[model samples]
Target: MPRAVNARATVTLLAVCWCVVPPRLAGDFNPYGINSAYWNSPSVNAAYRAMGVGTARVLLDWALAEPADGGYDWSAWDTALVHCSSHGFAVSLAVCGVPAWAIRVPGRELSYAPEAFAEFVCAALNRARTLAPGIVQSFEWHEEPTHAWADGIPPLHGTEQRDPSQYFVAILTTTYRAVKQAFPEVTVVMDGIRGAFHHVDDLYQLGCGPYFDAINIHQYQPHAPGCDDPSGMHLFHFPTLLTYLRFMANRWGDDKPVWVTQYSWTTSGWGWGDIGEDRKAAYMEYVTDVSRRLGFVHRVFPELGVSSSTAGAGSAAVVYDDGNYVPGPASLSVVTTAYLRLKVCAQAYPVWTGIPEPVPLLPAASRACAVVNGGFESGAAGWSGAFSVDASTRFTGAFSARVEGDGGYVESARFAVEGGRLYEVKARVKVDAPAPSSAAVWMELFYSSAPGHLGYVMPENYYGVVDTRQYPGGWRRVCWPYFSAPGAYEAFLKFSLQGEGTFRLDDVTVRP
Candidate 1:
């Protein structure tokens, strides 16, 4: 499942919001922050600071802190907060969950109040302030109040599945009053909403405008209009975003300083959202530029500085593993104990080109993968030629494609790929045919020019056919590595059966 629920990826066109706060991110030229639950690790916090992460988010769980009504435990919160504060990072705090004693929805962040939540926030902060003297905290009533477990992390107790507008507003209002009463200087942010376009209007209608000191955005780039690079979706997304931002100013009276609490691509790579590591780092670099370019986005938190199965998000962490601060794919290299590293530490980009630098004049980060229904779970909907989605046989997923006879074949949708890069197609194929049975993977490359002629493959691959007969006990693991010589713009992945009996293909993947 998608970790962070988000609006559909449309062409993005972001302009400066006039009422935005003057950004103070020019000092180190790094306007990035780290959000994760593993801040208890000193090495992880150290690595974050070295990587120029100057802001941190704390998802304070009320249930964990005060398991009993009046009893408070400060171990976890203290470690997370003190780690950031001691490292000189500004902390954005959002209390999460209600203890079991309080009525709460099962596993969902929901509606419950006796003004007790407000009081607990103040008490916790008061103690937190003293624990980490001079600790700076910007408070939000709850973490991701707009969505129930949208971050893919569920609460111990809480959600308002119904029209949550009035209930959310009520809680925010009470929490805002209590927090301000305790620490008047702390900024209270509103709606770093996920799927923000859908929920922003409701929050505004419920009179939530006056309770917030700033606005937070948790928008992530989608895979539809684009995810390979930044430029693809900006076209369709601009109107909606600019209009809503304008809508905020017109309806809510004045604009508030905006902070992108979350912006990142998960490296899970299981479904559509997970991106590759190298490209993921490129996205980090790209978003940093976007943050600097947009006047309203004061800081962009790259998210999950470190993650593990126990706490924080495992897929998107820049550093991961249990008990160890392991550098993730975003790092230049996994330089454990040798030195701290990050994407910014790699192949020299203009050092002055991030944070304070203007938006990059380059295309944004996106994926080039274009295989559709490769798993045949969609019943070969996007594939052509003679094939049937077999229900009985499978490798990992539900169904597999079956091709019979010499004329039978299964081909994928025509998708684009860049030239000069090595590409590979992999699949699990099972042959139940006689001795003469054979299967081949065919390749075809296209140029998107006016005449759009087929590009030539290397001499040996001219025919675009590679015969294979290696079938293991159950299924044969087939892999064909191909390359787009030059001027190749698009291509197709096809598998053909040459003999009598039927062959089953499943879990096909094209890697670029």
Candidate 2:
């Protein structure tokens, strides 16, 4: 039995849970995967590898698998599953598109009888189990139940008294029970909810909560400003998404994971607004960082493969099907880099038979050269400008330097340095709550000119970039190693915060 919880209590509980829970409890960070429909082309393996995702979604279409009662054909699906396994990618299968024979009205609609569909699902699960063994980790009930048809067949809500969504609850529970009975270890996820929260309420009203392991959602946010068709919708933004997460925790227990099966910002000329390519890349990376920090969304699969047949002129795919589906800037800058970072961070990220696990987060203390009260333990000694010891959050020791106000900079007292020598500067940082998309943290290395005038050299660009956006809400170690320019004698460190968010810095250090 489930206990009743109000929205406020749920959010409070979740907050407490997040504060106390070990940071790495949810160690399984599923890579950004592609939809099975998009990945079934001839160039799937190369595209999948190029995307650098460790998991592949293999959709098992009930319509194709069992054309008739007691009839089965597994050739194409078997081959696809084998290919994914051969490439060392885990598989998540979604069984959808009911066969006409199982439909009560005998139409090409999703309105199929519950008992009959459940039988078909059990048989398919049995076959997949035999074919792939333990490689298939998850089974999704359907593609998108609310928006099942493309040509306006309308979703399956039979009547006011006899809700079609209630029937879906029946199918989900029945199929879930059978799948569990057959394979207790496999994970069962709800059909990716495509419509609204009311439909979810409908399922909950029918007492259909115990059937699945996790909830799957396909949420697409619009492109940022600079796009011809910028999305004005706020539902896809981070704050709204957090509200939805709290709602789910209230409705379906916070322990169950939420998997975002499809997420991306479309390019211009698509039915959605025309967002430019660079903004698309930025949004993709931003959304990825937000989801990871939230910690509940276990998997994030951005739409990578754009199909010429279905996709518009400005397809959102990082790799297109045409010209042998070449990888683009979004693939390298966003998807590939995101995957490598996730692999390095996730505690349970699997290493293949021969591949070695990533090295652990290196300890920064031993390598750091002493700076006056660098850890902020001595209450901001030898520091200047709008900085104070923050006891609430610290990377090491009892306190850290907290910087408030937008565009405010903090500087360390001048430290001796040698010209033309390589040195490393690092800081452990995290954005204070209410972190806006525009909020950023940065650092600069200061030096003296020939005339003894103080000048600063930003390692790479005009403003040295310390990617606070990429940091996962919690404390993260960021380091920059650079060569001191010739004639640079003395040096100092400068840190600043920009936008409407607070930032905490600890263990600020420089070393040879």
Candidate 3:
């Protein structure tokens, strides 16, 4: 990505959306974190608290952690972790970077033993125990292994080279073995990849699924004010990352939550100069709300840090220079205005968008359909996933469940399954906005007696995206009639509304 020099871009495009209310989104504010070189001190951390952010991504800088020639020195990290903990912040540590003792070539990772690296990682978490016990939330593998400088996995260096995928899994496998043995619950993240397309495919194919709890992507979008349409063509758009990452996760059955460990609309001297200070701020607010609705993006961190000697970070720094602690405006500068705007959004974000996992919202239905409160007249009593009960919208009753932004596979209560029995699943769906992906009505099978969920069957008419135009009434009936459930067990209905759109479903019925 080249630097956009002398561009001095204008900002009116994104400013229009400044007043739009955040809709009833599919997900809520996940733990917002930041990777910053400057916000390392206790005083600066108050800035994070002002943003209502409670997590900070701290790189367990190896050189900073270990002393010269002997044992570990925990003080460098202690300063940051202790203050963060005091502010009720959880520290997520990333293990990457070079130590001064290394004799290897620069830009490439030092060829160190995996066990040694794992040991170092464990040591960091253990130290955090004393400063802020159990405050460490996740252990990240090489921050961005796709690149040379960002990679922590040691390069083969003159030896017979390993396949890049093999190298990635090897590091993950080694780290997983040691990290889990130490702290089983702490999420171990994959090497935060820079360019994901071909690289992510190799990781899954090489059986790297079981190693990490979350997938990490370092999203460096080439431009800014381009986040509204996550479906937009420009690839590195952060929300676009959410869309592709979800597909890959489902495709390989590696449905782990995605954390964008690093992202920024580069105001650096790089070609990204198309982004102005105000535009950068607007883009941050845009991606934060829009990406959360995708249902899979659990955490997003706007990266902070670039050498002062190098190209300037422009306005990407939410807080920079000093350790000043102010969430509100003392004086109205461009940076402070942006910070205050973001703070409002953060404060307004409703619930914790729990990591997208199968929620068993099981309570038998009032009727034979086995869907409890299917019309949502009784409100959000039985349904699980993101949606709200709106009295204004209904198919048959006084209310319907309103879902927005790629409503991830909303599931119903379990219904009894009989062998060779065909069932009909029907629901009235209303799409208020355009959605390009197919809406699926499917079943998830599970045995009440023995083994659990046996995966979802293919959608009845999954290939084509739902067309709301043909149905003039606005509310269209979607049906999968005569769909059979083979073998013995119980089943549940799931409606997956894909793509970025506002939709509602009510009057759901199931018949055998």
Candidate 4:
């Protein structure tokens, strides 16, 4: 289940928005603001000021806001808002933690009773408007809704299959109506959902697209293979998220601005030990470069128990231990060394290099397979192969091959196609019997869709320890589903055997 907003923090967000945006846009590029949370002391504020951060986001628990079913408290929030306004620090409020009274139900799902939830949203927004006047601009209703109850944290209300879109539409529609009635100039930003791509389409389908001004996303797994690391937070991740976002944008056609609400690179120590000062500096620099180049509204580095020796490299502003904000060292460096690169792009840019065309498997013919070794061998078949294709080639079809000989064995093999500089690889294998009961076969594929690119390998035959008694024969055909690509691509097959067995390979094809 989701929670409501804290009035004071809401006002702070509006103030920050007004402070950050210039009166006019400059060539599609604009600086919003830098923000941090958990900075309670003067030192933290000083660090944030040094880094040039203009706003700060703070957490406000619902339990504290409304202790009883109908009793409401606004004392702490009133003081916090006054302190922030007097000091010129704009605020972004994060509302979370369901109240005990709200969870009296038996199941995990909380029943809001439509009218009751609507009243709550209206009251919350009205209170916010009264306290902050014109300072509150955005409202992030819940924090990571997807993972809200992942780790055995029972929901305040009973358990039910709660659709996120239902909550968003119900709460946001009511809140937006009330907030706009009170402060029409405010900009309302949605909370960061855990899996944006995975759930965005469903949200759109549920008609939850038109309620907010912009979209918010959080990226924690910066370095997962096949994903992009635009912020350079992770070493191996490629930032594939952008590709999925592009796909969704095309589908929705909403043209909503994107904001990265939370992003940070975790070290091996997980905040318990030192993570080399130089590495920390480099990571920060990388994040700044990626954020500016990619046109994200704001990139926040949450200070959740982190101690960096090189604290000022990548951020436009820093959030320090004492709560004093300041401009970071790299902000100055960016102005001097890469200011021109800060210009926003006119159109979307390709994050990864395109792949080349795939070569034909046969010699200008239709189908063929090449053999590597002969006779009953143990570990003698390990070789690399490839096929070429034209640029921007799209292929979808199946390829088959087999190896036959007296006591012959394949160590490992794969199928693939190459293009200008990219290669796509898929693993391949051959079995003598339909269900091999004795040993397991390992196979792989390799190919590039473009020139000057290393080929990617994909596993074909699923490997596991199994009984070989089910399969005992010769020359069995294994056909796979159609593998397709936008650019040039090819097919590859590789295999290895544990026991002595002869094999013959053949029948490879690619279709549109």
Candidate 5:
């Protein structure tokens, strides 16, 4: 049975709203959060309150908490939870780092005994119920599992104790079942994946979707400018990060909400990719905005709130580790300023480049709206594809268009446009399958001066692969913006079915 909604918790959350968030934006949307690696630290309530953050993530290491088989130490965790609860911060406990004794092999802590791991989860959650009660809302299984860890620990075992995805499946499924059985209302988040997309893909293939409520991802983009690195291993920008998360969701055929558990810019000698102080502040501002705008993501934890001397130069702390707790360049204003700029740019080009809402180069007195038959009420009058009007499912209005083919596309009629103008295309989409099981549903914008042009002729960059799979069973709103070349005058939109799946699209809008 699901736990009853805690009235007191809701009241507390509302009170927090009054303290931090603006009156207009103070509703259910609260994405600003923090994740700390340190076991015990000074109070972060001041920082959290100042930034309008209501969520706090703390690492709960199994090794530190339990040294013996059933012996438990809840001292530090209890303090952490109480501290957060007192500050009106909802807590997300990340359960990671296997107890040394639980390890079957000396180095393979990640692939610890499943029975022991499951037992530990049940014990820990039970203790949390008594100690923190309603304050502990979410539980993440582990940290980054795919990439090599400090002790050569990967998702799988170092020895023959486990094979491929089997070991990981056992660990995740066991913990998830235990957690749900104990506290059904508590959201279960999967172990965050580092840049190891392949390992995550493998885990999904091994059938790990039904176990968790949300997907956790850790994005540490390269220190390089523009969020890209020549090695192609970098996720340098929020858009690229979103794209990767969506693609992974498409492959799983699951629309779980994504949680960026850790993201930040490290200064020179600050551990990972290095950037300057100004860039760090800018990235912090940009990331906060992206978290709010991206509807699918539930929360974004920006590295840490307080710095630690232990982290040395690689620390991505918004507050200096000095006893005085001085605020660094990456603080609340980085978040507030980003939100302000978003409001300012809502109607304008260079319009927040990631989403489909048209941002214009210059603010026009009157914006132009395109798309002849967006609602599909006209019954395929403006669309061409191996498709038909789908009245069964509609995001809005009375109808939506359905495409059931394998390789062809359902395209919109050409809309007249001026050359050298920027435009945005947005649509509400849903799927019969959780995601495209084989291939992906992709979108492209085509421009041509000639009429009746059937073949796609626009530059390859004009196409964007839609990752509808990341949406967790709802009408996902997708938006993409593009700049028309100096010589192009006409443009149309196309929704291509690259894989075998049924898709429903409605309320298509092309704005310029």
Candidate 6:
């Protein structure tokens, strides 16, 4: 009877455990691959592996693949394939770089000759299969096909330019069919059109949908004014681009798969000329997290390090110079905690319901002064007095503050209206909290905004960016600018804490 009771207790515990754990989806697909060119070298392979990349998309130039019309050269590729296979990494060949001889007209180019291009792709695939039988097989006709075809100067053909869509369709259909027939196990993916979803429709019209097993998209958004869409809505953001792709897949009645073949966020500095380490670290964290959330994102190849010497030319993943490969801090960070978190999340949830629910607001505190802890504790020494404000408050005037602490502190306070015009902000901050022996405290004024919602529209425009600074301690009045638009917004106060000591703030107010 005692043994029976114990067994019953064990069963009850198992049941409770099952109820607490969420159910996981079966057959999750991970698209965390890298774009590695042959020029990247072996160090790149090591870097990619370190970053937890299990697959690489290699460029197979048509010009180089077949230097002479009917002659083929697979020596370079053979070496690369062997190396990648030996390392247990899969390779997705991007067939691009049209050969000059293949163009029908002299001094003219041919975008697609269905039969010839198909033959070339099939031959290459056949050769690859024979050379590297154990390697995972994946293929994309070109990288950003729409951008390449549309932007080429002197155009591919004169009269035939009437509708490049037809040419693209023919090329894709023939190539896909030929490759698929030769290697049924291989996954054929249609490369993304660079600009927008509409370009994808062009490919769809060409009846290219049925031939490929997956669709590939590339996203390269730079953080700068006017570098991206004015809306500030990035494709990497959750459920934005992926949702649209799902709609497209449903429309086609073919849900093969989707792969973000290439995607990256650039720091303000570095490849584009300035390398801001902080920005780089932040961007890496953001992209890797987003990739993990968007399960379909198969591979991400940051254009690595750009030519730092050129300043704004481009950066490659690992800058190769002086016979040593130097990886940027951002790259290293992605390989560490950030990328691992993403992988774990992807494995846990293949398809996300949506963005994780917003964190609940902390419990209210005394007046406008809320006790800041958690991630905020590390920056406590710069804490300033906090204030509560209403719709009528215009926080642009001078503010007085006093704090009890051993260290010196500076008080700079201001308010900036955010979200709706009617919404006001009030902040009191103490900057630069002194060292271990001394404590610093003061008040600073600023606004609070969601990370990715700064430049959106009405209902979504309810966010603001907050900038903070630390200063020496003392009771002094500081004048700061504050204004607002004519809409609804939330009120927030920011405080920075610097040292090991404690400080107190009182008498906070916001006036219309």
Between prediction 2 and prediction 6, the one with superior TM-score is 2
Total residue pair clashes for candidate 1: 22
Q: Which stretches of candidate 4 lie over 4 Å from their true place?
A: 1-40, 104-128, 150-166, 222-239, 271-274, 296-512
- After TM-score superposition, the amount by which residue 275's alpha carbon in candidate 3 deviates from its true location, in angstroms, is 2.6
The number of the candidate with the highest lDDT is: 5
Off by over 4 Å in 5: 1-27, 37-43, 149-164, 223-236, 270-274, 308-314, 323-512
lDDT of 4 at 303: 30
**Model 1 C-alpha lDDT versus the unseen true structure:** 0.56
Error of model 2, residue 215, in angstroms: 1.1
**Could you tell me every candidate's TM-score relative to the true structure?**
0.55, 0.55, 0.56, 0.51, 0.56, 0.54
Rank candidates by lDDT, best first.
5, 2, 3, 1, 6, 4
- Name the lDDT of candidate 2: 0.57
Clashes of each: 22, 3, 5, 133, 13, 55
Q: What TM-score does structure 2 among the candidates reach?
A: 0.55
lDDT of 4 by residue, 66-141 (tens): 7776677766556546545544566665566666667534232233443444345445556766766655555565
Clashes of 5: 13
What lDDT would each prediction earn against the true structure?
A: 0.56, 0.57, 0.56, 0.39, 0.58, 0.45
Give the Å shift of residue 510 in candidate 6.
42
Candidate 1 lDDT by residue in tens digits, 350-448: 233322223322222134457788888888688998988899988778899988876688878877766544444557766664432133333343334
Stretches > 4 Å off in candidate 2: 3-28, 38-47, 106-108, 148-165, 221-233, 251-254, 306-312, 323-512
